[model samples]
Target: MHLNRFDDLAADVSRGLARRTSRRSFTSKVGVWLFGAVAAPLLLPVARGRAEDRYAGEEGDPRSCDYWRYCATNGYLCECCGGSANECPPGTTMSALSWIGTCRNPADGKNYLISYNDCCGTAQCNRCSCSRHESETPVYRAGTANDIHWCSANESTAINCTVAVVLGAAEDEV
Candidate 1:
């Protein structure tokens, strides 16, 4: 008996369809609802808290630019103005546009994802000189590049300064 590739494929597809049809009958609407009711309680605690809290850090001084949170930071310090380490200055709007930087957190010694958002409608705060480049790239590749001015979308003119805000820690790949 000689069997071709197409014959083997057809037999495999037929077996798959038979198994799917059999399995489909077992998963009814009532079964799905019952599964959710039983699983929701077990999963609630894992999903209840804010995901951002997992990357919270208590290290680094806001006044200094070379603080631990500013490991991969590239911009003017918000602390120089009225803003703290993770906030925009008063009267200045934090631009939704930002660059992602993988900064090393000294507290936990892990790389955290930091969003360097530009504070619009304000002059540049030239106090701190924190320019830690970890995975920074050139202006042509603006997605991961922190050197480029990221305030063009919010403000009409050039970017005044930038603020390093912790978005979250980098999760390990499974």
Candidate 2:
């Protein structure tokens, strides 16, 4: 008898819900929620913009994202913020810790170890923003990943720009 009573109550609740909303309305609401869940995260990154066009051979500009040294970089270029590719801006200091990348210099045709260091101090330099995902690694392998804030170890964690310093040419593996 108790089971029968619970079933009748459940049927009444379902009938009321069905009367209150149409199938089209329910599906449209679900679709909107699903779209928001999927697409919202893509817009959350701090940087937004298309990467600069890649140049052929050794002619690419350092200020652009397609430059040889920035093969795995994912931040604003220091070259656009009153600094060269290998140096931090005037006031900001380069973080000691850096994410590493191996990039082939178009001019030399040799792979070099590029240390992507972040300049910390002021707010982010919103200029020349670009992200090159070449040889990107998972976040678990933090040393090889470029999509993280590398300025966290400094006095001021505010990242201004990133400089890709060439450590040395990478030796060929046997």
Candidate 3:
């Protein structure tokens, strides 16, 4: 019986593979692959928490720039740049000075004081870029103006992203 060139090549490859690897080694490799496939899903929740879970009592997505705390935010969102809305990303520093904004919470019908702090020491995050001009003051008013570079005061002038942190509930204006 004559075998085709394809069959002969396949037989030669299989013989070479069998000569190099034992049955036990092949079984162990297959076992490892199966174990990895089975274990991947179990590790997902530990890696990334659900978005709604992260913002338990908040009204909107923390990753979005339209969140209630970001009424006057004017940069990339930290939540979308590997950090939470109130935290800076790894390797970045939060600005010492922050522009304050009073945003009303749609869920509670009360105003909250939001501190717009910029994360510096890295290039711009370029993700989830958002700018809301609501109640922004003129550029001359540095404390309330969102146009100023908050990262300029940091050791690194590179603006990475912005975090909208809730300082407290705003007092009612008399």
RMSD of each: 20.0, 15.7, 17.8
| Model 1, span 1-174: residue lDDT tens | 245743453344334323222223233222323334544454334323312332345553555543556656666677777787778887888888778878777667777787888888867666564565668888787877876666777744444566788777789521
List the pairs of residues colliding in candidate 1: none
Scored against the true structure, residue 7 in model 3 reaches a CA lDDT of 44
Provide TM-scores for the models: 0.61, 0.65, 0.67
What lDDT score goes with residue 104 in model 3?
A: 88
- Poorly placed runs, candidate 2 (over 4 Å): 1-59
Error of model 1, residue 165, in angstroms: 1.3
| Candidate 3 local lDDT, 51-131, one digit each (tens) | 254565666567655467878888888988888899999999999999988888877888888899999999898877767
Question: lDDT of candidate 1 vs native?
Answer: 0.60
Candidate 2, residues 1-174, lDDT tens digits: the string is 377754453344333333222223333233324333543354223112433334334445677565678788877889899888889999999899999888888676888888999999998898777576677798999888987887878879999999998888889721
- lDDT for each candidate structure: 0.60, 0.70, 0.71
The candidate, 1 or 2, that scores higher on TM-score is: 2
Worst 10 residues of 3 by lDDT: 16-25
Ranking by TM-score: 3, 2, 1
The residue pairs in collision within model 3 are: none
Best-fitting candidate, scored by lDDT: 3
